[model samples]
Target chain A: MNFLSFGHYHHDMCLVLHRSLQLDNNSMLSFTLAMRDGQAFDTVLSRAKSMGLAVREGRLLASAKPVARAFSIQDPDRHWIEIILEN
Target chain B: MSNSAFIPPNVLPPLLQKFAPLLKRKWFRELVLLWPTLTRRRFSNKTEDYGVFKPSLVGHFGQLAVYVQDIARSRIWYQKVAGLTHSRTSDPEPHPSKPGWTLRACYMSAKEHDECLVLLEERDPSGKMSVPSGMSFFHFALEVEGNRKEDVFAFAAQQKRDGFHLNYGPVQHNSEPPDGDGETGGNVACYLYDPDWHNVEFCGAMDTIENYRARYGDKKGSDRN
Candidate 1:
């Protein structure tokens, strides 16, 4: 599983921190996310909630620190949205 | 460090030098002409560097996101399997259809820093946002900074503790082993499986955090920034 093998993002960058995990021995790939703003986090979740989506774990914005914030959620299609608020 | 001199090929060893027209073969002459032409063609095109093709939309990426399912299960799994320590969570609130329906979510991150793991609630019924598409791009990396190699290894070890084994490089990570370069610090990273089977990789550049702090401390730092 090559890290750069990942398709790059144009308008937005994935800012790959490092290689996380390889799935299906190479079929699917998974990694974490660090969103830019808390508002971005809010906007994503709010839209999903508006679409009548099911909150996977009912856990969003689970933790907060002086410099950063961390939480986990799923997208409408079941993709995990790992939100991060770095100071 | 003296002027070294080397004799020329030991008097040109008696090898096949083909000094007559009989040595000229039709196929060999044709090959000689074709080689340089092909070599010229190989370097003539100006193809775009596909490697730099951005994955997200212009200004729309790092902004757009859709919700999915399996909240509670994903949360616990992320914490235990992804080395995430709880930071905070939102209080339960009413969901639209299931009035009086409570919506709860928590925030978690790695021990080395903050905002490493961000778990949100899917809240969608049809599950249209995050389906795993063969054409779809994978998730984001945490872009860790400082002591990156150490941090990545630690994260990997933690994943082992959580019982999530990878297929390559100890964590199924697909990249070179940590080199302790100051640029990325230590290519630290690990992976985990969310409840819905979405793969999540946590990683960071060695000195990214410190570089950021030094360059723009207190400035707004996001994917866009």
Candidate 2:
């Protein structure tokens, strides 16, 4: 429905959260966090699950795409938090 | 300030209609409505102060997700209108909303940055998304190439030349100055409508965010992603 960015908060993104709450209205789709080089993405993924987040690898809506060394977590806010290796 | 300045005679496509009402809202006017107040103005309390600390989420801001009626068509439109390029696409999958349809999506970026403007589309037999309100997302702003007022006008000029109408602006906007002199020191912004009727903005002079952060450094803290 609303988006906040680390670089700054100009609402770089927005998605309308419809009354039906259908997955269709997801606009501010995904926020990517690039880990420092050599920071095993698995460690982050593992820790995410420990924090009660559902972190996983797959092509599902909330899951990460097949981007290299990337994973996705369905955070409590229901936004897709994607972790990817810095190229 | 003719009526045509607000809504262009309905001569344009239906998508322009989607963008028209957004222009009428007071929030938009407040941003561009530089002080000296003919009437009261609303200011966004969002301050933008930040420290050099490495956050747990240590990555650049990424792209935004937008749903469209057609990915391929939308890609070309972004190119002509905003100069964004089609970068990559994810595999086509089942419609997350419609049971019988399949959907495909792609990313559009102005440069090779970590972020992108994603356009998601589904095959609709009805030629419409059928998703209640036309688009769930209201609008998103992208920093223009130069982040200057000239750049904003040049981009708007090019859009017009390319036949992509800017629903609003290319106008300079600023926040009320700390001294309250209304010196016009704010971001320059403009608004447009995508083919799918979603409002999109190409803005320059984005220091308003920095101004916000300076006044209010990362207050929400770890709660942010």
| Tens-digit lDDT string for candidate 1 (A16-38) | 22233222211121223554467
The alpha-carbon lDDT assigned to residue B151 of candidate 2 equals 91
TM-score evaluated only on chain B, model 2? 0.59
Please give the lDDT score for candidate 2. Answer: 0.55
- TM-score of A-chain in each prediction? 0.40, 0.52
Looking at model 2, the pairs that clash are A16-B136, A16-B137, B47-B212, B47-B213, B48-B212, B48-B213, B48-B214, B49-B213, B49-B214, B63-B116
Candidate 2 residue-wise lDDT, A6-46, digit = tens: 44544333333433333334344455666654455667877
Chain A TM-score for model 1, please? 0.40
Best by DockQ: 2
Q: For model 2, what is the alpha-carbon lDDT of residue B81?
A: 75
- Per-prediction DockQ: 0.08, 0.32
The TM-score of candidate 2's chain A against the true chain A comes to 0.52
